[model samples]
Structures are given as C-alpha cells and as structure tokens.
Target: MSQHGVGLRAVMRSAAFLTAGALAVPALAGCGSPDPAGKPLAGPDTAPAARDRIADGGTLRWAVDAVPETLNAFQADADAGTTRVAQAVLPSLYRMGERGRPEINPDYLESAKIVDTEPQQVVLYKLNQQAVWSDGREIGAADFAAQWRALSGRDSAYWTARNAGYERIERIERGASDLEVKVTFKRSYADWKSLFSPLYPKEVMGSPDAFNEGARRALKLTAGPFVLKKVDRADDEVRLARNPRWWGRPAKLSGIVLREVPREKRAAALTAGRVDVAEIDAATAGRLAPHEGTVEVRKSLEPAFTQLALNGAGGPLADERVRRAVARALDRRELARVVLEPLGLPAKPVGSHVALSGQAAYADGSGALGGQDTKEARALLADAGWEPGTVTEKEKKEKKDKDKGEKAAGPKKDDDGSEEADDGTYIVGEDDKARGDDEELAQDGKQHLKQGGAPGAYAPKGTAAPARSAPGPLAKDGKALSLRFVLPSGPGSKTLATVAERIRRMLDRVGIRTEVSKVEEEGYFKDHIASGEYDLALYSWPTSAFPATDARPIYAKPVPAADGSLNVEQNYTRVGTDQVDQLFEQAVGTLDEGESRALLRKADARIWAAAGSLPLYQRPQLVAARSGLANVGAFGFGTPVYEDMGFLKKEPGSPSGKASTSASASRS
Candidate 1:
C-alpha cells in the first residue's frame, strides 16, 4: 500500500478507540447541592418551573467579540465561535451525531445519500423530500448550489483553502422534492466527506448575485430553533426568539440574548449575576473557588494551541546546534508548574505540528521538544566557540570610567532643585558624552576626525570604538542571539507575558538576551506575524471538528511578497520542506484512516526535529454559573446548550409532582 493508505488506516484505529471510550463512559451526574471543595457542581433532580410568569420572560444575555462577516458555512474567514452563535438561529441540513459523526436530520432534510465518491474528484448529495424554509418556501438542491457558489464566488472575502475542494464542480441539479448537488474536484482527495455535508436553504439565500450583496444585512429568515429578533451592532448585542415555525422539537427557552463583553469584565459580571454564564480566566477561576456552590466549572478540550515558533530563514538560528541549545535551555516542567498548573489543570506539552488527540501526524512523543538539558546546551554553545567571561581591555576601561563618572556627578537636580527630573528623562555626564556621540554618528553619516576634516569624517585610527562582543559561546559572526517574544495585549495576554518572562530568565541564565512586547489584537495577526515583521511570537490556534483539514493552513509555507509581507499561511516558523509537504498531501489524500495517521506521525516527527515550533500546553475551558442553574452540560469546544438546562425551586404540594387523594373528605 502507498504511505498515504497506511497512514489513513492508523487514524481509523485510533478514532475507533476514542469512540468506544466515549460510549463506555456514562454521562456525568451532578450532586443535589454545590460542593464546598470547589468540585464540579451537582445536577438538579427537579424540573424547572412550568410556564410561570416569573420564569417565562427574561433574556439570557451572553457576550462575544463580533458578528461573523459571512454566515455562509463554506467561507473560511467566518469566526468559528461567532458562527456557532449564528447556528443557534440558523440550522444546518444535518447535525453532528453523539460520537462526533454527521447525521442527516429530517427537520431540514428527510434523507441524504452519497450518489458518487471519487476522493476529491466529484461527490454528490441528494436532499430529502420535505425540507422547507421558515418562510414556507421549499428547500431544494439549488440552495446547496447557491451556497457553494456564494462561498467560492468572486466577491467572497471569507475565502478559505477549503474552497479548493469545490473548484472542479460543473453544475448542481435539482430534482423535484429531492435536491441533487454535484461537486467536482481538481484532484483526488481522501477527506472529501469533511467538505460535502451541511446544506443551506436556497429560498433565503436567493440567487447567487443577490446573496452576495444582501446576505450580511438580512437576518429574519431561518429554519433553526430560533430566529433573529433584533440586532444592535453598535452595542454588540443580538436578540433571538424561538422559531414557532421550526419543524423539530421546539426550543424549551423563550429566547436568547447575546451581549459582547470584554474579557476583563466577565468575572465581575458573573459575580453580580448580570449574566447567566461567563468565561473566566485562570486567575479569576482561583478567586471564585471560595464560592464553589454558586459557581460551576466545566473542562473541555480547547482547540487553541499555545506554542513558540522558530525563525528558520538562516539567521542566528540557522544551525541545528544553536537551535537545540536554545531548546535545551528551557525548563519545560517549570513552565507547566509555574505557568499552567496554577490555572486549575495540568499542562500537557506537545512536540509537533499536530495535537495529541490528532491523527498519526501527532504520535506519542516527548512531553517537550528536547526536555531540560542544561549540559547539552552548554556543550553546544562551547562547540560554537562561545567563550566564558572574555572581556577586552577596552571594555574594562569603559566600564571603569562609567562607574567613576557616576560617583563623581552623584544625582541630577531639576529646576526646583529636586532630586529627579519631572519629565523622567535622564541627564548625561562627561563620561556618557562619547557614548552619546557614537549613537548620533550611528544614526547619521557624520563622524569625528582628530585633525583634518573630510566630507565623511573617519574616527581617529586607533581610537575607533570596539565591536560589540557576542552574547555567549554559542554565537558567531558578531550576531547577537536575541529573541523577541510577542504577546496579545489583553487579560489573557498576561499568561503569555508571564511565560515569556520565565523563558527570558532561563535564557539569560545561559547568556541569551530576550525581550517581550505586547501587540493589539487587530494588528497582531495581520501585521506582526503575517507581515513577517516579527522574529517570534506566542499565539493560539483554535481547533475545529475536523482537525485534519483545519490544521492545514497553520503548517503551510509562508508565501513571500514584494512588500516583504507574508501571506495568511500560518507556517510562522518559516520552515518548509518538500518531504514534509509530500507527507501532508498524502495524509489528506489517503482514504484509509490508519494509513493517513501513520503518515501524519512521520510528518510530525520531521517538523518537531526541525524545531519549527514548540507546543507548550493545552488550556482547559473554565466557565462560571450560579447554583440555581441545572442540567448544564459542557461540550468539547466550551459552548453550553442553554436549552437543555433548567432551574430548581421549592414545590408547594407533592414532592414528585403526584398529589394524594382526599378519601376522608369523600367518606364524611
């Protein structure tokens, strides 16, 4: 069998094991009351109040960043989190089964069948007989066709790599109540099923041209459990009402209200009972633990990944020795204990492009890249000719003169004879004069000459400033082994900053200089890393249900541009190899799950060995809620289904909703 085939088979075996495990485990039951030890809250035994005025009319407010640019499913740039909220109002043709498998729902589509499958070539989906839109319009194959065209159409700003799968399609055909949608592909693709499902409504989408212009503004028409009642863009709030026309089990809740709240304000809002549920940071989670009964904690697999990217364009880190040395200098265990463990859960270090739960590309490996190896680090640096404490006579003289001048001048005085400057600017003394002159000369072309003056004056022959010494024994060619760690400037950004500081201290112990900087969210992804203007950054990659396809963009090569900006591809490490690319292609193209996974493992090993990136740990999803809430279950992605939840109250009569007969009164 081909390598791709082998890898695909392996992935299937692993997936099978995971599926079995999920089935064997019973659903988690909650205690009757909250636990004082901050353990998970117990489930409520009693049902919520029945249609009472006190419980009937209130908006369950939630928060998020913004509305998705494209509600269309095929569009790549659609924020997954935002789309999930929209999905509550807009239903998909099918929903994921309990085991994370896709199943056709009769509410939207009575049945669906795969008419043809030739890997990536062409696949067809036949819709059900009775699928209809909320506006009382029939949904047919044309809807699916229009939705794909809308996503892949010329004007789509949300275009994604997934679009490439639909490039070969010729046309979609509609047949009476049954809709036949045909997809043609440019090449044979093994994971075609990941792209083919999920049909949208045609009547609401309208014609391709019309949808391209109006999809963003129109919000009322939908076939889901809820319909959009009001949208306040300026205030970042969206109100939803249960869809009376919904064809399935009606939503239990009256409506839902989504509000956008900043990360910092979520904890306070949860405490004040302004919101039913809120996402809390690690530190906030610790602070709220004392009130365990009122707050509930749910842990889920965050699709996000935190890691360090290497710059492999042949600068200071061009050699493997230096790269391995730097990796060895890091104490991964301390990072987890000090940085991640405090947040509530243990940190699992990753060693490659793929996550632990991922397919073969991410097989069992070391917890961290190389583990902690200080001896190996020093040896590598020594091999690179890094000297220990080698200071030239000139440097010694400069240090002595600088110290002497500082003592003689003492402290500076302000105009009011105060000790310090009001503006916080430093004053220079005679000993600092030469250093300032050198800095100015470096900025401009002008230089000082001893006797004769020239257009471009030269420094007096022997009096030239000494070249800056290399940072340590590992550095060569006078290049400083410096790294800049870029982090997000938000509440969650603090975690990254702390990690960066620890790393800085570790590297500094081995003579490496490191700096940390925070960038705004808007420009962070687009300008800092995407523009190729940064050396290194600590960022997260949100996961999708389909890890195989969703992770493709992050490892793709950095496409260069004339203006020096990198493309949207996430290969931040700038390390791309023909072998690795071939394996990735094979893994995606292979039909058998097991074989695909094996190939993925090989690819992961190569990437890890190359030091392209270092995976730190997986973050747990922490959520806070009040004690009165019941039936609240968490999903792997951290989203909670409020409809399945209820509340507890004291019963006025029977304990089990059963009343006793008044036999004595009847006898009298």
Candidate 2:
C-alpha cells in the first residue's frame, strides 16, 4: 500500500491490491532496454522451449525480500509481501484477473452484483455454501458486518489503515439468506469491489481488542488454498502448507516456504538452487539473463511509479511557487534514461500520479510541471521574491555556531533510543504511510530496496543537464533556497542516491541548494517520510486495480487530530486542494467508466498544477523463476493463482513432456 498506498494511501486501498502473475516465456534480452513505446520486446531465444509440464508435491522456496510485519493485510504496515502471502492463504470475494480487472472468486462467493443503484448504491454478495474458514466457521453475513464496522471510520479505536470506500457505506446487513450480505453505501461508490478484499472473519474484526490483538502473533485461521505453518523470525522465513479445509482444487505444491533473501542475494539464491522463484529488478534481470536457459526473467510495467514528494505543509517546500520551481528544475526523462535505459528498459516519463501506463485512464500531465525549465524555475522563484545571493564562509561558520547552540538546547533522547519529544506516533500520508518499533512487525512498511536503481552514474547519453540562469543560491527575505532530500540507505539504494544526487546537481544549477540525506532502511519511512521530517523525498506508489478509490487518500486534505498531530493516513506529501478532492469525489461517484476516466484525467491536471509530487516513470516489474517452475512467473496486472503453481516433473523435450503438459494444462 505505497501509503502501503500499496501502504494503502488512498487506495492504500488500491495499491495494496496489486496485480502480478507468473511470467510467460520467450525471455527478454539481457540488455533490458524497453522498446520505443517504453515496452520490452521479448527475445526469440528467451521463450521456454515449451511450457514445462506441471508436477506436484514440491516445496517452492520462493524468495521474499523481508518477512512481513503483520500477516493481516488490512493492518497499517502491510506491504506487497503481506499481500503476496495474503492472496495465497486468504479468501477474497474477488481476485484480480489477468487484465488487471477484478473477477468474482467463485471459490468464496457464488455471485456479487450491484443489486440497486437508486437511493444509495447497494451491492449484494452471496457466499458459496461450501466456503468455510480453516477453523470451521462458515463464511457469512457476520464476517461482512464486522469488517465493515471495523473499517467504517466510525470508530477511531479500530486502527484500520484505510477507509476510502468503506467510510461511505451506510450499513451492511443480511440479505434473504444468512449467507448473503447486503451492503448499501451512503454515497455511490463505483469501485465497491475493492472493499472487503481478502475479507476477515468476525472473530478477527469484531472489536477493538480483537482487531488490535488478534493479528499480533499469527493468523488464527485462513480460508485460502494455503495456511501459515510457521513464522520463524530468527531464521528469517515464513512457511505455508496447503489448507486441509480447502473445498476447491487442491494446491499443486505440498507447501510454500517464503525465505527472506535480500534483493542483492536473490540471484545467488536462484543460481545456487536455494530458491525456486524470486522477484528480480531490471539490473538483476539483466544479470541473470546469461542463465536464461535455466532461469526465466519476466519483465512488465508495474502499476506503480517512483516520484519526488515535495513537502507542502512546512519546510522550504511550503511555498507552492517553490514546489513548482523544484518540479520544473529536474529532468525526469533524463533520470529515467540514466537509471532504466542502461537496463534496456523504457525511460518513458509518467504524466499522471494516479494512473500508470497500462491503465485505460492514463494521461500525461507532466507538462504542467513545465519539463526541465531552469529559466522558468528561476523566474518562478524570482516572482516569489527570490534573488540571487551567495553564502559567504563567515556566514557558514556562524550558521554552524547557531546549529551547535540549537543542538545544546534541544531535548535529549531517552536511553531506550526514543526521542523525548517523539510521543511514539508518527505522521502517515493518505499516500505515504509506517514504524520499525512495532517488533513482530517492523514499523517500516514501504519496501524501497527492490525498486531501487542499479549501481551506476546517472549521466544519460543524449540529454544535457539543465543550465542555471541565476548564478548564486536563490534567496528571499534572507532565507536561502535549500532543501533536505531524503532516501532509504542500504543495499540497492545506489540508484536512489545517484538519482538524488542528479536532482541535487540539477537544482544546484538552478541556484537551489539541496542537501541529500539518507535514512537507515529500517527508519526510512517511519522516521523521515511518514513523520514529515524532510523537505523532499523519493519513493514509489504501487497501485491496485482500483485507482479512483485509491487516488483520493493520496491527495485528499490532511485532517489533523485534536492534539495537533496530523492523521496523514496516506498523503505523505501533505499536499491537497479543494478542486483535486472535488474531482476525486466526482470520479469515484460516477458509474460511467468513460466519464469517470475523463474526470480522473481532469483531476490529474489539477494535481500536476499544484506540483507537490512528480511522476518519474512506470516502475518495471521483473521476476526470475526456475526453468522447471510451472504456472508461476511474472504476472503483470494479475495475481497468481497459487493453487495452480507447481514444478515440472520432467525437463522440456522429455518423452513424457507432452502427456504431462496435456494433464497439467487442463488444471491451469
């Protein structure tokens, strides 16, 4: 939800419901440059000799970057890892289809339909009679009611991560049968299917105590094809076994073991045959391309985009003109070109923050940021009362003295490492949302490691760096133009550091002094981003199938608690406007898909105009799987059907391959 917005930001709700699938063979070339349209072209040699025939009863040692903080997908800190596990072991009324569209899951629900649209929209869901929890509780209206109540935003104590569409519901009641759930919204919601996904049981969602404590140690029960068997934090692994209570087709593999292999070591794990499948990035994909005959690297555009979030509430970024100036100063295309081009990936500049390229509603609105205009950046700063000025050595010395004085006066941190002024709670945006202190769950939810750039200098081949019109640091009222840029620090952060440096250099040419800071990987989101402790930051938002429902929380107005701390939910940048929120409301309220899309585009234009964040490019999803793995690989805009995944019994071209393919193809 990037707020785990795959933080579950607005669609902290949508991004959390990501679409991924096993990759199809005919692997991409070793040099991963995306084609002209910013898409990757499959290489002739990369294709699987043929689909490896499926064989059952093998343990899949899948590589996950980290162990999930919480198994409960709805929790505030849940990330893609949580969702990956959740999809395999939990039951949702609907699951994402291959096309990134939602399809009703027949295993859980017999049917789900919009029964009424008039006086507040109504959705009726009928549960499958045979569908039951592993604990033997029948899936019914009570589970639906409890989930709705817990997420309705009526109870502050529930501690739910997002309440986008659920907050609009008037009530959830039993329909004609005990198994039927009737949900009526107070306001029309076009993407209601995004709700109750991986629905929780009554026992888990019933009360504040249950909601908070039930998911702490481990899941009590699960209704998916798999059930958690062990969570060995010491060993850094989570193991899942096929659910005995499953009423559907049995899972092909006997069990799944998610091993926490660091991104840097995943390739080694695969090469060593320690792991069966792993999520690979562009660089890693390229590195593994040599072993294409043995490993399949699948590449696709992810429903996410890396961005530069400018803090709008306080700090140097508070001024809209300054925010706009910062947006105009950077060369986003160059950044992409430098970072992704080397990977043989597309460097297409993203225009909309809400919609990625593959979505029907996507539109380029980057023009509002005015594409690398340093002259315009200077002019904007000038119009905002800025003037060129240089900081002298004496002034720097005095500033250091002042900083020392302030440090001496500041409150000391406790021996336990907690800040005296910290109060424990941190700010989370409707879009940027995390914490590492929560132990069983590290507070940091966003996974910055995997999506980080490969190690290299970010100097693109053809693009020239922007030139500065103003010579010295731009200033106004004696305040020098300076920004604190923060990014996660650890392995895989080389690209982010280089990108930040590139931005710093570009902004430097425009007379804006940028101080790049790196937070430890564990405290990156919690201490810096979610807490609003930086002037500017870099991160990505991975969207779910429901963009309209998810985009609002990322850009909606920040509502502060009475105590004055912001209840950021998912909007980490703390940027919003009446028009943006109004358009978001209109887009989600409309039932017409075309009209909804048009409204979203219009809303994106407004978002661009405000310039709190800039969409750089679509984040590439690359994964590497063993040659014999079947029904699993790079799933783009689709969730893998875990039940269908298995390892091949015989290598391709073997004598029995045809019969094995025929038998397993039918199962798929």
Worst lDDT run of 10 residues, candidate 1, spans: 434-443
Stretches > 4 Å off in candidate 2 = 2-52, 135-138, 155-157, 207-209, 281-292, 391-470, 559-561, 565-567, 651-668
Clashes per candidate (backbone, < 3 Å): 30, 50
Q: Where is model 2 poorest over a 10-residue stretch in terms of lDDT?
A: 436-445
Q: Provide the overall lDDT of each model, using Cα atoms, as 2-decimal numbers.
A: 0.49, 0.68
For all predictions, the C-alpha RMSD in Å is: 16.5, 11.5
Candidate 1: C-alpha lDDT:
0.49
**lDDT value for model 2:** 0.68
Q: Write the per-residue lDDT of candidate 1 for residues 634-668, one digit (tens) a residue.
A: 34332333344434433467343211111110110
Residue-level lDDT of model 2, residues 375-473, one tens digit each, is 777776776777887798986897688669855865334333432211111123311233211001011112122446333335588767656344787
